[model samples]
Target: MQKNYEYDAVVVGSGPNGLACAIQLQRSGLSVLLIEGSEQIGGGMRSKEFFPGYLSDVCSAIHPMAAGSPFFSQLPLTDYGLEYINPPVLAAHPFDNGTSASLKSSLYETANGLGIDKGDYLDLMQPIVENWPKLAEDILGPFKIPKELIASLQFGLSAMKSAKWLSNRFKTEEAKALFAGMAAHSFLPLDQLSTAAVGLVLMANGHLKGWPLPKGGSQAIANALLSYFESLGGKVQMGWMVRSYGEIPPAKAVIFDTGPKQLIEIAGDHLPSIYKKKASEVSLRPRRI
Candidate 1:
């Protein structure tokens, strides 16, 4: 809105979140610039070709969360070459004995394979899976009073427990392993409070939209978003690793898709002391992949 500013908005990072934010802003008629540190963007969605002819995902492999996303689902990403390949078996957990438990898009089908825990798994997931569309908005967003009150309350009560506590409901190791595998995606200890929420949300996503892989690898998702953003007149720069606020171009608004450490490092002086103290207190550990 300000002519003196270099751009209406500047987004730091070219990850999915950054791309989505830039795309939305550009769609709303804002002049936006997206910057990425790496030569290639994508962040978690980025892929590497370790072998001569094959590609491997750097961080994330499967994508139930993105595929099932209400916002992403509504986007014209598919039209922009963002094809998702949903394998029949969404996710699986193998045992030492060579037996494995797997999940599918069908709730009843996946539950039936859990042996004795079938009944319990069905009972736990039935309501959540049934109300996924209604719950997606509130569950994936900031805390608020949900329009679907009773359903949200039901999901909240169960989702608030630790993964270990929730796992206790299952008798079979297959069921436990499957659920634990999903919960571990949260990157938190299973005994920690609210860890079950991550597992539940992931599982619900699997049921709603099976864990999918982008047709051309994870990069396709980022490329699709970027292409769509560019279609709306957005601009992007790669390998511009910003070290401080001074390195950034002037803009009316700035949005970061980075960690607390990065934020503090780049804009420490501008940040309030109380906010800086809180940000400094955060100790982010590397993912145990």
Candidate 2:
């Protein structure tokens, strides 16, 4: 006996990952139904009019990850009206004296601005920048044996150090402060181990691709993804909130683009007690406070 399903797959959430998942499923000849809780999709990529006509992004204003993403690079988003605007300076960190340390698209150009730390900066970043493609492929996703063993080893050694430790390598406050500021985006204390990795990756991306903003707004990226998904026959239902597993339409599979907390809430006892307990413990940890 064959079971009939209204959709081959049901994707919860309409964030970039969810949209991509639904799109890929539809492309693979599976009927996908993408449900979004909010009236509009895009989640963090959405933009709204702050004033009468001026539009501002709700979240994720600049996109270094988007520029360097291997998955996003393969998509024909430009055909769907998504345009990326790269600024001349990738990022700027101003000092009290009114001078600034800026990250530039060229490694040499960025190093040149570091004054006394020019050689140190180049020595620290040049190799990683040169081997970025292989390094990114190895580390950006799940753990796997690295194809570029030497490059991954070099990146791993530096990345594992605390940002404070890495800062000591630079003699100049301009270089140190710039690196610290970049690492702060990790939301961890500068002295924490592996925080340096976040800073280094951001700086590496800036040198490789120069952080870009989507033209019009960040929503353009989502809209383009949605347009592309629709072209592949993926159906999206806005304002469809799934409070429980029962709320989802009959589908062979369901994919969640949400955190562990939401997953436990929706699936409940359908998931193993041990699994749910772990998810709850992790979700209820002090970090949420």
Candidate 3:
């Protein structure tokens, strides 16, 4: 007899990216199947009780970028029973000197808080703030030539320069702490240009859109997608990890959301020599370096 299970497309992983891809595919009328390695979904967005009711973010703490995101805005998470708590002051940068500075949803408030440096901060953030959708499209999606990638890089560099300058330009220690705190989000130390850029971009977004947390839990987002996928005649297999082509149901097209290393490891035999060589180079690159 023939096999009992199959799908038009199978997505490996149940992270936000994987679920998003699967949701789109399923909505397109494809017979989609989502396989997740972990028992629960949500990936980096998952929340855990770190100190009993503290509910620390397992990976990503804030949802500032998500709030500003056009992709997410269209998803209508509210309809899926997810409401966001938009904080007035999106983020507060507290210093040991009994002072703190913040980025708020109100641009005027953030500027007023900065005092004299307000103009300088606006100068650095205004363009990106105004063109946030384009900025996000460039960052979150696939790359293409003549894309906003170059413009985005330029924006980052400019923000870094401004942040570094403000570190010295500000008269109040509180102001400097604000800039430094935003920069620290890059996971880089305070002095680096890249780190400075990360901080400024985050602060800029907070001014444009307040940081928020999803109603219920991050898992709600995943559950909604999974529910939608089921509603659209798609099937999902939780706790099923695809280790190779043989492990997946037959499909016309496969969407692998796993990292490049995993893809190459599983599909190396079928890949072109040129592609395989490129993957090898990536594999050789030091993960931490």
Between which residue pairs do clashes occur in model 2? none
Deviation in Å, model 2, residue 177 alpha carbon: 1.2
Candidate 3, 79-104: lDDT as tens digits: 66666688667778787877668888
Instruction: Show the colliding residue pairs in model 3.
Output: 182-199, 183-199
Query: Looking at candidate 2, what is the lDDT of residue 151?
Result: 89
Candidates ranked by lDDT: 1, 2, 3
lDDT of 1 by residue, 74-113 (tens): 7899888999999889888888999999999999999999
lDDT of 2 at 289: 14
Q: What TM-score should be assigned to candidate 2?
A: 0.94
**What does candidate 1 score on TM?**
0.94
Give candidate 1's error at residue 282 in angstroms. 1.7
User: Cα RMSD to native, each candidate?
Assistant: 2.6, 2.2, 4.1
The candidate that achieves the highest TM-score relative to the unseen native structure: 2
* TM-score, one value per model: 0.94, 0.94, 0.81
Question: At residue 69, what lDDT does model 3 achieve?
Answer: 66
CA deviation > 4 Å runs, candidate 1:
1-3, 285-289
Ranking by TM-score: 2, 1, 3
